[model samples]
Target: MDELLRLDGNAAAGVLGEVFSFEATTAEYACGGCGRAGTLGGAVVYEVREMGVIVRCPGCDNALIRLAHNRNRHVVDLRGTTSFTTG
Candidate 1:
């Protein structure tokens, strides 16, 4: 159960890159909830099955991003993040 819930960000890189136009899994993220910063590759990824993917801050365990796809639309919610930048 736990194994299915936790995976490295690399697992979702392809899907994330498609939405960001860049390699998002290698990007850096600052958590709005804790102000802690970490690379997306270091973050934990939670797969919501066919729904989408959830990325959490490795330092604070706060959700940093949520990505979902519906039909031809890609939905991305970043309320959990204060800032994101690529290295």
Candidate 2:
């Protein structure tokens, strides 16, 4: 598909907040590749309808977070992140 659709990080904030029990957009995440820390709200988020969401670091463009769904469960991976702070 030549057309690429996307949405801002804030668009997923509500769904993420439901899973985290906090305002996910306000949570700070440190990128493992760049060591830059920023609120998740600032990350670039790409939504893949057939799979899930991919969150990338704003500084180095490294994939910081990924959310996917399997059979009957949802999975979240933060391997690209070194640390995370939730308030």
Candidate 3:
């Protein structure tokens, strides 16, 4: 008998795509109060615009004045978790 092992990068990437759908531009800012790098966590959502996606920090709940526009090829639509399998 032989054991079967499976690995799929595409599938993993697809899952990741659904999670992180937004793209960040070259503009990076640190929190003036907390001095924390990178964006905040929690249910952080944004709208895509010509200038950029208007985002807010989940940590401080501060509205980002401006963010450059960038492209994220890994955007995926994950409305439901029906595709996922659980044991």
Candidate 4:
């Protein structure tokens, strides 16, 4: 993804706040695909539809996180990453 189109993870803090009790953008993620590790603030994020977001690895473009709200329900997927941790 183009650098200019990428929004800082903080920009999604409002939406992420709804799902995580702690601050999510500050969480660390280890990419399973490329062995890249960093805070979510440095990941590549794709805003999907009107109610969803996808977080990808900045190094390998692997889809590491997925979040969606639909039909009054919230869905979160993190299968692509090796680990997602907050400390």
Instruction: Please report the candidate that would top lDDT against the real structure.
Output: 1
What are the per-model numbers of colliding residue pairs?
Answer: 0, 0, 0, 0
Report the lDDT tens digits of candidate 3 across residue range 10-66: 222323334444422222445443444452222133534333333344456444332
TM-score of 4: 0.85
Q: Which candidate is the best by TM-score?
A: 1
Q: Write the per-residue lDDT of candidate 1 for residues 1-87, one digit (tens) a residue.
A: 643467898888888988888888778888998999888988899987767889998877888999988997889999999999987
Query: How do all the candidates rank in terms of lDDT, highest first?
Result: 1, 2, 4, 3
Please give the range of 10 consecutive residues that has the lowest summed lDDT in model 2.
1-10
lDDT of 4 by residue, 1-87 (tens): 332245666666777888899888899989989999898888877776566888888788898888889988779999988988994
Model 2, position 41: C-alpha lDDT score = 89
Backbone clash pairs for candidate 2 read: none
Alpha-carbon lDDT of model 3: 0.34
Q: How high is the lDDT of residue 22 in model 2?
A: 84
**Model 3 segments beyond 4 Å from truth?**
1-28, 39-43, 48-52, 65-87
lDDT of 2 by residue, 1-87 (tens): 523346777777855764688898888999999999998988888887766778888889898888876775668899999998995
Model 4 worst lDDT run, 10 consecutive residues: 1-10
What C-alpha lDDT values do all the predictions have? 0.86, 0.82, 0.34, 0.81
Q: How do all models score by TM-score?
A: 0.88, 0.86, 0.29, 0.85
